[model samples]
Every structure is written in structure tokens, then in C-alpha cells.
Target: MRTGFFTHADCSRHEMGGWHPECPERLQAIQDQLIASRIDPFLQHREAPPASLEDIGRVHTQSAIARIRDHIPSPSEHYYSLDGDTFLNPFSWDAALHAAGAAIAATDAVVKGELANAFCAVRPPGHHATPTESMGFCLFNNVAIAARRALDVHGLERVAIVDFDVHHGNGTEAAFVGEDRVLMVSFFQHPFYPYSGTSDIGAHAVNVSVPAYSGGDQVRQLVTQNWLPALHAHRPQMIFVSAGFDAHREDDMGQLGLVEADYAWLTQQIMTIADQYAQGRIVSSLEGGYNLSALGRSVAAHLKVLAGLD
Candidate 1:
């Protein structure tokens, strides 16, 4: 089985504004890089289906779902603000559904042995939206939704969520705070946006917050010391990754100094863990990455590892 790459055209239709960093072009950048690196042909590409509300409901409240469904802007309105950063355009609802759906479908494929692993390239990136609220340029927590599907529907005894985004995946953490079946490990820049991971997250979570300007070596050290041990002990039946590349040194979105090599190394580490304990099952979804050039290159590097091209 090949590495599955899931995405949808609808994802390109959801855009905040011309000025926003989380633009539709983010998806295009990823696609362009995959082609440039000659990795596109090696992937098993699939068009993402829209997620059923039931699938979404596993991780989100009905009211929260209603808020997004109830408030989609008409064509003439152009945009409706959900928060300072999050907005809903006419196509946003469909795009969000597909973004989340890509994660779910990918998870299903990986769990069922139809593919070696999968990567979701849809957006408005998730991981910041909690169960009750959609914030931080997110309408639904895609990774969280995928994790829940692995647990509830697939009946997996242990699953792990690995987040390497520059920002803390507070929403993903919130979804499985006390749930023993799910173990989430992440590293984010300290004193940053949404600023919530510093406190005691939960017994099942290993959140490492690094200071600004931290480099790849520091991150690797922390992962070796912290994330690896927890992941080994968890012995997960499957793995979910909130793959975000904004930590790249070139990305202006955050201050951490990770490069494309760092992302490739990180993916290798996660893949090693997946192979050892999870039958090489992994479903990774795009979470954050703003700088177009860097995001493209970083994703390509990550995919190289996932595809075993590296």
C-alpha cells in the first residue's frame, strides 16, 4: 500500500481575506511542492468527502456545530466573523467539513490497512478549535475528530496524537484531557498564541513548551527525552499527527527555528514509533504553516519520510 494523500477542491474555496495568512494558497503551495519534489506521483491521491455531522459530533457539541452551520455568510456578504481570527465565507462550511473528513477517511484507510499511512492537505487548519467553540482560524478540530473516530468506531485500545505545531494544540488536548485511550504529545513555542499549555494539561499528555528562537537541536533533544519515552510506553494501536510546519525558521508565523530537515527528522521519529507499535498506521493532517515557500518545502520533506522516499 502507498501513502494516501487526501484533499478536496472545496478546501481552496475557503479563504478569510486577501490579507490573511491562512489563505487557500496554502493548499496550492503544498501541491506545488509535492510536484516539484517529484513526490506527487508516488502518493495515492483521493478527494475528501464531506464529514457527516455524526462524525463531527463525536468531538464537537451540537451547539458548536450549529453555530458554524447557522452562521454561514451569503455570497454577497463575503465573510462572517466567528472570532477575531476565524471567519466563515460561503464555501467555508463545506471546506471545513472536507478538511475534517479528509482526516477521518485517512484514519479509516490507515486503520484498515488500505494504505501505509495518509496525509490530509485540507484547511482551515484545525487543532485549535475546542469541542464547544471554534476559534483560532478553525471551525472544527480535525485531528481530534480523527482520534475520536479511531477510538469510538474502530475500537482501538490505544492511539496517540503527536502535534509538532509552533502553537499549542489546546483544542486537541481539551478533547482527550482525561481519556486514557488517547495519549497526546506535543511541543510548542512558549508564551505564544492561545497561551494555555503551560499549566498542568493532563496525566496522559506530554506537552513540551520551548522558549522563543529555539532551534532544531533543542526540539530534537526534548523529543528524545520526553516524547519518545511516553510514546514507547503508550504502545499505541495507531497514531494521529497534527502536522504543522510553522516552526520552520523561515516561517514568520512563529519564532522557533525548525527547518525542512527538522520536519523530516520529526516525521521519521513518529514513523519509527508507528512501525514499532502500531503496525505502521498513521494519519497526519495539516494544522499550521503560513509562509508559502517554507510551508511547501517543509511539507514535501515531511512527506518524503512518510512515503519512505527519504
Candidate 2:
């Protein structure tokens, strides 16, 4: 079976600014690389529909949703800031909706046997946005929202979210903190932006925050000593990943110093868990990565694993 690729044209319409790293071109870069590398041939494509208000409300408050909508500017005008680094342009809302919708729909497809697995390649890279705090170039917590929908709406128990974004997914961790049903395992740069996710949160949140320049070996050691044991013990019913490539040595977003091999191995480990416990059910969404070619190559590497072509 083919892995599903979910995205929308509207995702390309939102632009934060002229030189922002989190630009619409990120999506195009992934698509172009996939095409150029013949990686798209291994995946099935689907156009993501706009997410409903209820979908957004799954991980964001009603007031937060209203706040995001209240700031949409006229096409003639352009940009606004939700916070210091997170900016919005004329089409930001619609792009965010589709970015979120891609995850939701991909989750539905995988859980319903419509696809083997799915990858959402939409942007505005969500992982930093908390339920109440819209920061870190993210407006909505896309993977968190999808995981909740899969659990509550689809009646699945024991869902796990594994975030490998170079930066700590403070938002995802915050949303699922102290919740037994959902387990969030994250490895990120410590003392970084937002800088939260250090100690264990109750028992459900497993975070390993190390210093800058910790490379692939460090990631492997930490996962072996920490994540693997916990993951195998939990044996999750479904798996969701916040796949961020900023950890790559080439990307300056963070200083984790990981590469494509690290991503591939980590993905393979998750796939092994999915095969054993979750019936190979997994859903992943792109989170962060600034350098264009690095993002493309790393995404290709990641998706190759998702498709089991590696």
C-alpha cells in the first residue's frame, strides 16, 4: 500500500514576510525535491480540505480561534504578528486551516484503512503553538489536534505522539501533559526558544533535552537509554510524529547536529513499533527546517522510511 501525502494549494498562499525562513516556498521545495528525486512515485497524493472550526477547537480555545480570525488583513495590506517571531499575512488563516486539515484527514485515512500511513507536508510548522499561546511561527497545534480527534472522535485509546523536532514541542507536551491516554516523547535542544520540556511531566510526558551540537550518536544513545524502553513498555495503539528537520547540521534553526541517517533510523524504530503494536498505523506532519535543500533532502529521507522503501 502507498503512503498518503496530504497538502493544499492554499498552504502556499500564506507568506509571513519577504525573507522569512518559514515561507511558502518550503512546501514547494519539498514537492520539487520529491518530484526531482522520483520520491513522489512511491506516494499517493491528496488535496487537503479546509479544517472546520471544531477541528481547530480540538487543540485551541474558542477565544484563540477567534483571535486568529480577527487578525486577517486585507490582501492589499499583508502581515501581522501573533507574537515576536510568528507572523501572519493575508492568507495565513486559510493556510493554517489547510495545514491542520491535512493532518486530520491523513489520520482518518490511516485509521480507516484508506491508506497504509500518511505524511502531511503543509507549513506554518506547528509544534511550538500551545493551546493558548500561538508562538514559534505556528498558529495551531496541528498534530496535537489530529491526535485528539483520532482518540475522541474515532474512539481510539492509547495514542502516542513522538516529536523529533530540534526544538522542544512545548505546545504538544503542554497539551498532553499528565494525560495517561496520550504519551508524548520528545528530544530537543535545551535552553532553546520557549525552553520548556526538561524534566518528566508526571509520567506521560517523556522529554530529553540536551545541549547544542549533540549529533546522531547522542540521539541514538538517548533514545536507547530513555525513549525505546518507555515506548516498548507503553505499546501505543496509534502513533503521531512531529517530524522537524531543523536538527540537521546544515540547518541553523537549532544546534542538535543530526543528519539524514539519524532521521532514517529514528523513523525505522517508530515503524517497528507501529508494526508490532499499532497495526502499522502512523501519521506524521512536517514541523521545522529552514535551509531549502536540506529540508527537501531530509523530508525525502523521512518519507522514504514512512513508505518503507528504505
Candidate 3:
């Protein structure tokens, strides 16, 4: 089987504002990189379908869903702010639904043996939107919902989620706080935006807060010392990843100094863990990455590892 690549044009239509960092061009950058790297033809590709409200309800509250739908602006209107950072434009709701749906679909495909693994290239990136609130450019917790789906729909006993976003995946942690079926491991730049993962580490959550200006060596140490041990102990039946590239040194969004090689190494580590415990089942979804060139190159490196073309 091959790796499945999931995305949609609607994902590029969701606009927060003219100057917002989480613009629609993020998707285009990924698509362009896949073609440029000659990685496009090695995988199965599919257009993401809109997620049913029920799929999102697995990880988000009913009220949160209602509010996000209500926040969608009419085509005539320009934008509606969820907070100072996150906002909704004309196509925001459609894009959010599809972004989330991409995760669920990727999970399904990997679980059913239709693909060796999958990568979701849709956005606005998820990882900060909590179970009852939307924040940090995330409309819904896509990876969390996908994890829950693996447990609920696929009848998987245990699943692991690893997030390497520059910012902490507070939303994903919130969704699995007391849940034993899912284990979440993450590394993020602390003292940063939407800061909450610094404290209240959950039993099933291993959140490592790297200080600002840290380098790839520091990140690799944390993953080797902390994340790998927990993953081996848990022995998850499936693995999901919140693949964020905003930690690249060139990205102004965060202070971390991760390069494409760092991302490639991380993906290789995750693949090792998945091969050991999850029958090589892995689903990775895009989270955050702003600098177009870095994001594109980082994603290409990541997919290269996943696609075994490295």
C-alpha cells in the first residue's frame, strides 16, 4: 500500500484576514512542494469531504459547534472574530469542516489498510481549539477527533498522538484529559501564545515545554528522553500525529530553530514507534507552519520519511 494524501481546494478559501498568519496560502505551499519534490505521484490522493457534525462532536462540545457555525460570516461580510487571533471569513466554516474531515478520512483509510499511512494537508490548523472553545487559529480539534474515531469507530483499544507544533496542543490535551484510551505526547515553545500546557500535565499527556530559542538538539533530546519511553510503554494500537512546522528557525511565528532535517528525524522516530506497536499505522495532519518556504520544505522532508523516499 501507499501513503494517502488528503486535501481540498476549499481549504485554501478559508481566510481569517488579509494579514493573518494562518492564511489560505499554507495549503498551496504544501501542494506546490509535493509537486516540486516529485512526491505527488507516489501516494493516493483524495479530496476531503466535509465532516459531519457528529464526527466533530466526538471531541468538541455541541455549543462550540453551534458557535462556530454562527460565527461564519455571510459572503457579503468580511470577517468575524472568535478571539483576537482566530476569526471566520466567508469560507471559514466550510474549510474548517473539511480540514477536520481530512483527519477522520485519513484515519479511516489507514485503519482499513487502504493505505500504509496518510497525511492531511488541510487547514486552518488545529491543536489549540479546545473541546468547548475555538482558539489559536483552530476551529476544531482535528487530531483529537480522529483519535476518538479510531477508538469509537474502529474499536481500537489504545491510540497515540504526538504533536510537534511550535505551540502546544492544548486542545488535544483537553480532549483526552482523563481518557485512558489515548496517549498524547507533545513538544512546544513555552511562554508563547495561548499558553496553558505549561501546567496541569495529565496522566495520559506528556507535554514538554522547550524554552524559546531552543534548537533541534534540544527537541531531539526531549523526544528521545521523554516521548519515546512513554510511547513504548503505552504500545498504542494506532498512531496519529499533529505535524506542525512552525518551529522552523525561519518561521517568525515561534523562536524554535528546527530545520527540515529535524522534521525528517522526528518522522523517522514516529515511524519506528508505529512499526513496533501499531502495525505501522500512522495518520499525520498539518497543524501550524507560516513561512511558506520552510513549511513547504519541512513538509516535503516529513512526507519523504513517511513515503520511504528519504
Model 3: weakest 10-residue lDDT segment is 194-203
Alpha-carbon lDDT of model 3: 0.92
Index of the highest-lDDT prediction:
1
The residue ranges of model 1 lying beyond 4 angstroms of the native Cα positions read none
Give TM-scores for every candidate, taking all chains together and pairing residue i with residue i.
Answer: 0.99, 0.98, 0.98
* Candidate 3 Cα RMSD after full superposition onto the native fold (Å): 0.9
Candidates by lDDT, descending order: 1, 3, 2
lDDT per residue (tens digit) for residues 173-290 in model 2: 8788777899888899988987788765677878898899899998999988888888888889889999999999999888878888889999999999889999999999999988
**Alpha carbon lDDT of each predicted model:** 0.94, 0.89, 0.92
Task: List candidate 2 stretches off by more than 4 Å.
Answer: none
Give the per-residue lDDT of model 1 (tens digit) for 78-195: 9999999899999999999999999999999988899999999999889999999999999999999999999999999999999999999999988998899999999999899989
Q: What TM-score should be assigned to candidate 2?
A: 0.98
